[model samples]
Target: MKFALNSNLRPLQMALLGSMTVVAVGFAGSAMAENRVTYKSAKAGTSYYQMGVELAQAMKEGTNGDVIVTLEESQGSVQNVMEAPSRKGNYVFTTPPSLVAAAENSKGAFEKKPDEKYKEIRALFPIPSLTMHFVTREDAGIKSFEDMAGKNILVGKGTFSANEGTKYLNLFGLDGKVNLANVELNNAVPALKNKQIDAFVTAGSFPSPNVIEAAASLPIHVLSMSDDQVKQTGAARAVIPANTYNGQTEEIVTTSLPVIAYTTTEMDDGTAYTLTKTFWEQRDKMAGNAPWWNGVTPEMLMNVSGKMHPGALKYYAEKGIEVPATAK
Candidate 1:
């Protein structure tokens, strides 16, 4: 094939080819500009997972599809933080600030396999907190932490609630005095109804579905902690306002652990900025649909443990939000 004389095309043909090349390049650029982030949270059916879905939808709507968020089911906060070392490119996960601090220090869950990448993890924004709920049967006669001394309490295994509940009991001097039930949290309401356990502890955002379900089926009591008790736990204080659930008359003051969305240093500053801005801008809209979102506020940033992502920091600064010195 010796076709060497066609070195130059006609002016119109050359112009068309050049225009097509420009169009092709523009399409490529547009694709590159589209940021796709993977959002990992809790199990598929949990409240936290639902929040992830809502946040994904909000991100899409707020960014006009520029920033597309894909949701991934996570086992728990510990798993979320553990996977950070190997995850790549715009991966965001939710976890309590304490767990992030643990990962950074190579303590607790990360002690067995510490990763240097954990230090690179950065905070995005706070999400709804995990509020502790001490639910009891109305007839159980257990109203305060002290009254639970002789009760059978189910604090599900391998969760923040279980660990914190055990700690609180010990801190309150109950120790081996209480009969701690060894069972899953899913059986809590049924166990209580059957008189198998006097009370159970759960940790979630306020108006927890499990609490609502229990309250709806049977008369229940939500225990309130004293100011001194809350301070002793060294956790953030949260209040479940009265009438939040059926038969819930008085507000229950409780302890809370703040949860936050976090990303790694690998994410570009622009994408992080967009994600953070979109989250706050759409928060009210999300809250209108899911009450859990209502718990999130700018002030909760003080609870974030690690340094803020530079991109997220940029958005916060623009809004004049007060970021904690520890997270700055």
Candidate 2:
């Protein structure tokens, strides 16, 4: 077909197409960078908080700021774990069984649809957490978990721990034996001093200044979980060695919140790979800045029961470990 093209129209069309391609490329690059992953921690002024700040700094230094990480200080793991994908945060300072806790209480913590109830967060690395401290008056004589049944317990109420032990204790069929008393951090110490509460379970990974101060002055006791009970709490609990707490010695055993390093499904496989990489590559810098960062290792992040994120999985696949189907 013989046709005469308008030269002016041809150049305009070419220019238009070129502009569209440039826009497309720019759009893709922006998306890649803007897909930021946030890491949240239970509370501020704690080791978990310090480690998270170190991690974001490491990401900025390692990737030259290609990955902008946000650190959202949170109430506790119970709340932080649910904030991922809500634009609240991505990674979290959580314990071994946080996902288990989320799974059991999905509707309670997450924005649940009948269809999608679980966040299924992955364990990135294990951050050593503080004691699941059962601080009690020395005269209380509450030496065992069974003994906790009938006594008044001072728990951090309307917050992360949310008296989780009460549920577990009830599960153990110890209901009615333990009187439940919930209070915030402000009144907890005074209540214990006045004998208003028999024992208090405080979860802290960093230097819990108040609790530690309380321990020093009150002549308190830290209780231990038997080996069998340790296994039963699933991923959320771990047996801390005796002497973990000051002032209370003599194999006063206790279980700690497993403080696992974590990230969300929002992070893509490649980005997750970089984060998982930075988490290890900058371990020294992080640990130097914060003691809790010392505990993280490659194996601690992977080799867990839950599935890793796709980005994390992609990183692991290089080491010849295939992520399970649930992970994808």
Candidate 3:
């Protein structure tokens, strides 16, 4: 026999059901508040991509999982900038200030696909600079840029190193006198070991993995550039401290292209502030694990191009970190 609801118990049952519904809604709302940001950087296995992975972990843990970061593979900085205009939600990417300047001016790679939306890009935080490493085989007898005049040098094709190496060779009047190896950077170490190339130019943060590998496997020398030479290249000056690699004894001065994490106006002020704040607060922690991150400092913020995201600016202002007027 079907039993009818007892009138006295009906009120208690309704109240219990209402309370349960309210608790469920609260949990759902909390879940919805979690933010997911897409981070696009270099291709897999590159230092930048690895940094993205570390940063993602730091963000998740530091925020107590309120913020989640997802890393995406990118061809290079140009491709990252190209996607910024079309990307929605909270999107972040890393690139050199020069590329941002070019994109803003619709020059170089951005010339054909220039979009007004590019103007919305904003700076978040500075990352490690792409420091140049002029690694030469010890037996090659190369001590400086001038020594590469007759040596076989491998500057990986279509990379920043290749472009800068060409410019430096021409600047020092050794253009045609040197043999530039045409090969991928992944082959540089093997090529150098096999005596196919006497030296190679690679760009990454120091201690650059490739440089460390070269220095560890064979006797190597990192060429130093004069202050005047670095100035002529028109890139940021960087110094690889002594013993950065296995056998390196003296600091090697070189040029670097500053890279920065960037986002667009689509992100809310709160989220931007959280990201910027978390980055600085957790930077030292990140550095303890990855030495490359140790290179990042508040002073590097001066290199940031475009305007700063308001949230990031807020953090800087609160922390008394001086930001460039141009980035303000």
Best by lDDT: 1
Per-residue lDDT tens digits of candidate 2, residues 185-261?
66777888888888876766533555667776687777766767666665344444444446645654444555566
What are the Cα lDDT values of the candidates? 0.92, 0.63, 0.91
Per-model RMSD to reference: 2.2, 6.6, 2.3
Residue 196, candidate 2: Cα error in Å is 3.7
Candidate 2 residue 95 Cα shift, in angstroms, is 8.2
Tens digit per residue, CA lDDT, model 3, 1-328: 1345577678899999999999999999898778999999999999889999999999998899999999999999999999999999999999998888899999999898888888999999999999988889999999878889889999887888888878888887797999888768899998999999999989998778989889878998989999999888888899888888988788889999899999999999999999999998899999899889888999999998889999999999999999999998
TM-score of each: 0.94, 0.65, 0.95
- TM-score for candidate 1: 0.94
- Tell me the spans in candidate 3 whose CA falls farther than 4 Å from its real position: 1-10
Q: Each candidate: how many clashes? A: 0, 13, 0
Order of models, best TM-score first: 3, 1, 2
TM-score of 2: 0.65
Worst 10 residues of 2 by lDDT: 109-118
- Over 4 Å off, model 1: 1-8
Cα shift from native, residue 36, model 2 (Å): 5.5
**Which candidate, 1 or 3, would have the higher TM-score against the true structure?**
3
The list of candidate 2 runs beyond 4 A from truth reads 1-37, 42-51, 61-67, 73-123, 126-131, 146-150, 171-174, 206-210, 231-237, 248-270, 294-306, 314-328
